[model samples]
Target: MFTRCWLWIGRLLRRTLLITLSAGLASGAIGYCYYSLKFSGPVSAEEQIPATEAADSRAIIEDAIRVVEQHRSDTRVLRDAHAKAHGCVKAEVSVLSELPSNLSYGVFSQPGKTWQAWMRLSNGNAYPQFDRARDARGMAIKLLEVEGEKLLGSRSEQDFVMFNHPSFFVRDVAEYRQNFAAQANGQQVLAFLPGWDPRHWEVRHLLIALQTLSPAPETPLASTYNSIAPFKLGPIASKYRVIPSPENCPSYTPPAQNRDLPNFLRNALYQQLSIDRVDACFALQVQLQDPTHFMPIEDPSVEWDEALAPFVTVAKIRVAAQDFDSREQNLFCDNLAFNPWQALPEHRPLGGINRLRKEVYEAVNVYRHQRNQQSQTP
Candidate 1:
């Protein structure tokens, strides 16, 4: 009996050692390949170029349209190929005063600037998906009737889109193209493999980041949304985060009896809005430095370290009390088109991901409108 136990322990130890050795070798090889592709020198402010060229932008846009073409054919449902709205609510964005000079740009220039905004919250899936599934949540805001020269020619509205996570799964449009290509082909494993590879250190780093994830949130108000990608703040670059105001904030108190609801998240928001008004705020944070190395303006995968420059409250958002859950309101949300490109030039989005978004969003609108037979309006 003693001899048998000794043999069993020896075999287990050997197995563990073999597994560890294999993992180390795989990691080392992956690291070597990852480092091979890196640039040795730092990018200076002068050296910094626009995130995307016209050619690349066109290519990314075409790729996105082609990929979604199959999806449109398959579903025949009127929806954005990305986030499909499950909830829509109205809000007021009250611009705060006495901000630092650097922060006082574009929309924040005036102390008392205010706009009537519509908030369209959605599940980050192509269809009206089950709410209990683990997926990213989207917050699309359209700040209306603001007097300004806008990016979406002759329009005065500023549109902002956000996700629950702070960093993107892919760093740029090229990386995302491959992932989306794989997705369109119904071979999502292709996208998953590169991130899983031991050789792709940058991707591994993104994998380790909390921002590349979205846990199932109990309610839209309870979950925080991040702009993940940066935007040009006058001459500076920055990101945004939105959360519920501390006073009478929405919560996640689930009843003991109801555990298996398919649409819990949507239901949760409706219940709260049904009772009374909801309030929330948006915090604008600036990027401290160009950070030539890791935290570059071009990389959406790298999280800007908050330790360098903490965020300041440059703006506050207030959601008005209303029956936002009604069918009429939901349909209203569907008709609206929201994009970061629909903004003032000062707040123009900056980054490869954002550049990709410019074209992808347009393509999405075209596809969505064609499918739904809705009027194509900018």
Candidate 2:
């Protein structure tokens, strides 16, 4: 009887050991999968370029900067005008689940499973425009309540992203300064600046002219925008994009003469809400190649190769329908600041142009706000 009991006890102990070993193996596999997806996925090829080519590119950027300084003066005028025209009232604010379907490339870092955000939609231009024109659309988003060490500065959770088109008139900081100079000084000075390429100037002029023509009369709130900056994500970098989804309303282009763009956009948003809730999902795309791979860091004229790393959708943004015409919503949307420098350590802006943005954008914001306040007092 004693011998039989010992054998049964030994068998039960063996079964327990086998079960424990299986559970440990399973847990190890699960942990490895999680780490691989989060860290190993975004690694990219190293970027390299020739020295002579880089020097030439630098010269071109220097010339562009000179041209911009000669032309652009008093950069704060337009921003102040925008603030005043829109009034000082704060707009009603709310958190969104996802971005609209039409605006595809919006990404925001969430803290504690919640994203704090503020957005403003406006007609894009320097100032003084034909109200009936097909103006460029502006969408500025500030993702607040973020938790992370900022890329360059001391501020935490301060990131601003502004977008117009896939490609920008100038690619780096020196060129952007030159472009601003041209705008400030008007077209006459820009015509004489050495190395002032007409083709390049034309692109910038054309964008401004288009903005002058495009007016958001019908659906002022419905238009979408993008961030043209090339940003780094861990070892990989990409340009951020945003689009408006057409889940509810079929996608349709407006007529040439869109006189009621603002109202049309407002009505469409309202209609979607009245029936079923509307949702906007912004897709995040990363560019695979580094800056040194295709073009020099200074020159904005050369286009980067898009085939290597195509855009991938990573996150979704949703906004529920509500009355946007209220005074509260206007104030929050219009006055809230958006800066690209507000970013996580993984995603930082690259190249000289991005560096200059840190100074120029902040200065512009401060100057404009000050001017607006001064103008309002009796």
Candidate 3:
């Protein structure tokens, strides 16, 4: 009886060891796959595969329109992305009095040249939400009286559209189409979640999206903004950024609690401009693309290393003291359309993503204006 019991115990111990080993191996495999998908291998800028454009570009743009329509159908007010405007202020974008030869490109070519412009600050939501909510922010500067032909409309206006974040989440047109399709089909969650299929996983993009929509700044003008994608800086490719002039802009003091203040961001802007009567200023800077793989032309998700290629201040954007939240001003801002494609030839938007934007933005602009019964231009 004792011998039989010993043999049974040994068999049970052996089975338990095997099960433990199997579980460990399975966990290890899952971890390896997760890391591999989250952080991809290095890609050379020259060797990066160009996304195929044969897939119907029109369909992609239509999908974007449909998504926006469905998103705002309940409210019956159709607005494009970044639909809510905090305020549109009158401003000026003046080139630096002295600029380096390499930095003198496009709008920055003529030193000390100032252009009358409208600076629209906005929260990056498809529909207006509480301003205190953590979301991406936008700074769109439309410079009027710019000479020469434009890539889009016949207007002599040039728009510099930027987001507070330095890099975008989508890598290319293909990925952009996928995102629109997912939103249109009401399966937007799938863009981030990896269900049973690993191929549909977008862990990296989801991480980036979270970073993009981080906490809102104390004020819109207080935060820096970036183009994220590349554009033509004369013969070379580059990105642009607008840094807040801290010395000129006042420091913000938040309330002890903000659960009651939904529009605190807009209020901060108002207090700074109308109440305090301070001039807000920013340094418009440019960063040229590196010759190697570090600063990619295709992937907007990959932030160009500032340590490798630092941004050079090319111009100054100044907003004088004014009450920009008037009803008439808000109405005018609502009608305004700021498109990146509405640019001078020398500063044409580059990369497959921007090419898609040229089409998407145009279609969305027309559709939105027609729905609102307003002119496409402000």
Best by TM-score: 3
Residue range 1-378, candidate 1, lDDT tens digits: 999999999999999999999999998987787655553225333223455455566776776666555455344544444446657888878778677888888888888677788888887776556666667888888888878788878777888888788777776666666666666678644564665665553444346333433556766776677888888778877777786655534543532223277667767666666654444444434454355544566777767767665667777887654687777677677777888899899888887778778887878787777777777553
Lowest lDDT sum, 10 consecutive residues, model 1, at 39-48
lDDT of 2 by residue, 1-378 (tens): 999999999999999999999999997887678535633323233333334434444554444344333333355334422222222111222223453333222233322134555555554554534444455555565555456567645444545465444555554444454555555566533532425564354444345434434445444334445555566655555565555545533444432333444334434444444333444334333344454355333333333555654554444344554455556554444445556776766667665556656555555555545644533111
Cα TM-score of candidate 1: 0.82
Candidate 3 has an lDDT of: 0.81
The TM-score values for the models, in the order shown, are: 0.82, 0.58, 0.83
Candidate 3 structure quality by residue, lDDT tens digits, 92-118: 888998998887877889999998999
Cα deviation of 341 in candidate 3 (Å)?
0.8
Clashing pairs in 1: 30-199
After superposition, the stretches of candidate 2 with alpha carbons farther than 4 Å from their true spots are 1-114, 128-131, 151-160, 188-224, 248-277, 290-303, 372-378
Instruction: Name the candidate, 2 or 3, with the larger TM-score value.
Output: 3
Clashes of each: 1, 73, 0
Order of the predicted models by TM-score, top scorer first: 3, 1, 2
Q: Estimate every model's Cα lDDT from 0 to 1.
A: 0.69, 0.47, 0.81
